[model samples]
Target: MSRRIIACEVFKPYLDKLLEESGVEAVDYLEIRQHDHPELLARSIQSIIDETKDVDEILLFYGLCGNAILPLVSKGIPIKVLRVHDCAAALMGSNAAYRKRFEGNPHKRYHCLSYGERDDEYFARTSPEYRKISEEYGEDNADYVFSMLYDKFSTPVTYIKLGLDGEESQIRRKEEGYYSVIEGDLGLLRRMLKGDDDHVCVTLHPHEKFVGIYDYEEILTTVNRNHDREKTREE
Candidate 1:
């Protein structure tokens, strides 16, 4: 079957390596900044799905991502998506693994190669909504504003190393704010690429709409469009 991958750009390095080894070249990497607006991110992905032609299946390398993928509909082609809360959980291998590390620490921040390398740039681009506050109040005040907004005081930062080159040193050089490192597993991603529709993935057949679930064990599921519409109306 002809398959294509539509993934977040943050997974580019790992996916690049995997795709090269597997000789799978049909992939579209979307900007990580789109994540700042869940609705816009969903629309962007839907546009890509609408534009793709002759592909029997699309592998989506994403988590529910604040429900960004919740509104996505399969336009004839089937879509397979990872069943994790976000990229951090996907990198950790599963939601259970992620919860083991961060179940009670809601204020903790997650850092991976992509996030660590572009820390400043990521914040600057993803938080354009705070630009006016920064401009009007100056940077120091902006920092305070952000801290208040996110409750970031003494927030622990966990960096997950997927054995990528230069990742260790980069973690060491990162400004120390309760920072630590842990090994990450890419097994789930590898399975996804290999078309394993196991527990870590949710597959949506043609015309099915993706939906987010509150339970971490289940993560996500799909429903028929008409059923989803009626459910929404009932709510």
Candidate 2:
């Protein structure tokens, strides 16, 4: 059966590479652009689900994403989503791997993104971007927007090094904040694309709400219970 993956635009490059490398045939994608808006994301996801009613085993390349997935349980179809807080964990392959980076540093406000995403003006928040936002919504509104979203973060925006060079990394860093580098691997993404196993994934059954899954126990319980359900269905 052909599978589908609805992913965020931020993960487009990574997902493209993983799917290509995995050689997973007949897989389709729907990329949503709502990194800053969770409501739109939820609506987009539901629309995609409605559009792809015939498709089974749909994969979502999303995390809790500010509770956007809270309302996106199952709409009578089986789907798999990573047990992660955000794409940061997906990029690192797992929550443990993503958290391991902060074992020593322990910066809660740490933000990670791909180098290619640095150019998105929506994420820029200054210069041409800020001017654009200010013109469209006024300077006061712009400040309010930034304050509500990005102001909470204090540490340098950490860029996940994914085979990019130092100069490119430097360009991606915002001038107002500092910069740091960390290695990233697509192991989890590859596994998902390759359909190797569900070790790092949780399959949601019909009508099951995806509240959140923070630890291995949560993942195991959800996945294992789903496995049993599948077995029962087969029987």
- How does each model score on TM-score? 0.87, 0.73
The true-versus-predicted C-alpha distance at residue 143 of model 2, in Å, is 4.4
In Å, residue 217's CA in model 2 sits off its true spot by 6.0
RMSD of each: 3.3, 5.8
Misplaced by over 4 Å in model 1 are 124-133, 149-153, 176-178, 228-235
Lowest summed lDDT across 10 adjacent residues in model 1 is found at 120-129
Which residue ranges in model 2 land beyond 4 Å of their true spot?
24-33, 102-120, 123-129, 140-152, 164-177, 213-235
lDDT for model 2 comes to: 0.64
The residue-level lDDT of candidate 2 at 147 comes to 68
Which candidate has the top score in lDDT? 1
Pairing residues by index, what is the TM-score of model 2?
Answer: 0.73
Q: List lDDT for all candidates, in order.
A: 0.81, 0.64
Instruction: At residue 191, give the lDDT of candidate 1.
Output: 84
Model 1 residue 55 CA deviation in Å = 1.0
What does candidate 2's lDDT look like per residue over 1-235, in tens digits? Answer: 5667887766666776676766645434444446567887888887886677676677877777787766675667777776677777777667787777655664544434443344344445664766888999999987887766566665565666555334364545456556565667788777776553667666777756565554533432233335557888999
